[model samples]
Target: MNVLFNTDKLTRLIANLQTFTGIRTNTFDAAGKDIQLSGGHSDFCRLINASPEGHARCEACDARAVEKCLTARNAYSYRCHAGACETVLPVFESGTPIAYLVFGQLLDDSSVKQQWENAEKELGWYQGDLAELKEAFLRLRRFSPREMAAYAEILEALAQYIQQEGIIRSAEYSDLQKLEMYLDRHYMENLSLKRISADLHMGTTKLCTLSKKLSGGRTLTWLIAQRRVNAAKSLLLKSDEPVSSVAESVGFSDYNYFTKIFKSVTGITPSAYRKTNRS
Candidate 1:
């Protein structure tokens, strides 16, 4: 769960983006912790967040947006509960999402009147100066649909730049840790390189590379076989199950292949290992 990045440089870049685009930008880590890089929230949002209920709703809205973006694996745009437009773009490293770039807090020019009416209805639940809130809401920067699309493109490019520049990355050790954990949990199932790669949201080649690194230069198949053999050894010593049963229980469908792999890994057949290790 360790994230590495240059905070100062990221903050500077976000700030400059905000200055140029008139749209605030922020980043959220995989765990959904916000890293506020650009300037503060817009005056309209600030007024809404001032109320306790408004703050809670805003948090929930953001969480839902982030979840949708992660599921879509692309930029997601939506109108917030308070009626401002926002977009969330996920940042990925080697097919794994590491962070998100959230930009937008403007009024869509075509929908301003409707948005204002909706915001006024929702604002009744919040204890704020209604007139001041309305004024701030009206003052929010407005964008046409085409302009919003342009900003979305800009944010998408920025996300790629962030990855290329290593503005955010999951540590190599963490990557290895996750890979090992996944293998440990599912070694007994029917496993394959494509399945594991897809489940881990990693490329097949990268999965193989990390597996080799984890197993001290062995291939990913070796790691899986090693896990299955280790489990088979435990079963052989602890239980009197038949050799075929033990192999099958540990994901070895073919008993003969299991024997081959067990000998390769443990330097003995399963039965021999059990007999020698047992009291």
Candidate 2:
């Protein structure tokens, strides 16, 4: 999914928050892919990620937290697998989540000793140096219950600022725009009219009509060809790969057909286009 946002601005905002709070913050797309402003992972987390088993458990823990946050439709805080407290807040647009803001890699002051005992027992399977892990764990910041609640409020307000300022947004697309986005993302795959129709939930005939109307009488097939040719052109200009290799990369299996389509779209052969454009 393509999330529209001012990445630099979002980074600045989150970085400022991290600087002020002494806590790490990160942004993730709806699909759980990191966006930017990772603020750096805590030493505790780095240690967890370094162990293969610990890494897998950490990912599972994060996935569950994201799912819970989506279910609550608000910030959800929980004790991580390794016992640090973390919170996740989903940024919603039109009742749909576009992004997530996650903060908190700290412990609660009231439960530090008990939580550490739990963490040590839980991570007993970890193969790394246990003493170093304990040192990192003990170094985590601690907040009282009241302070944690206040931090949650601060995170909520930050989420609101991100939404109100349009730092992250989900674009509402027209049918044509939807088609274009789908094609752009899937152009490297084996695409057919039937597959497009099924995916878009539009009848094949209606899709054909819409394609013609939006594309000035061009067919969907032509649009796909044009998309592939455009991608090929970028590769041709930017890389020294062979034209045939470029053809395969852009979904054209047959070199002869790729040459024909390239010529038909750009009024020049791929090789010639590359030679002239590069010069």
For residues 195-230, write the lDDT of model 2, one tens digit per residue: 999999878897888788657899999988989999
lDDT for 164 in candidate 2 is 74
After superposing all C-alphas onto the true structure, candidate 2 shows an RMSD in angstroms of 12.5
Q: Highest lDDT: which candidate?
A: 1
lDDT of each: 0.87, 0.85
Among all candidates shown, the one with the greatest TM-score? 1
Worst 10 residues of 2 by lDDT: 169-178
- The alpha-carbon lDDT assigned to residue 275 of candidate 2 equals 95
TM-score quality measure for candidate 1: 0.62
Which digits, one per residue and each the tens of the lDDT, describe model 1 over residues 177-274?
A: 78999999999999999999889888988898898889899899899998999899889988999999999999999999999999988899988898
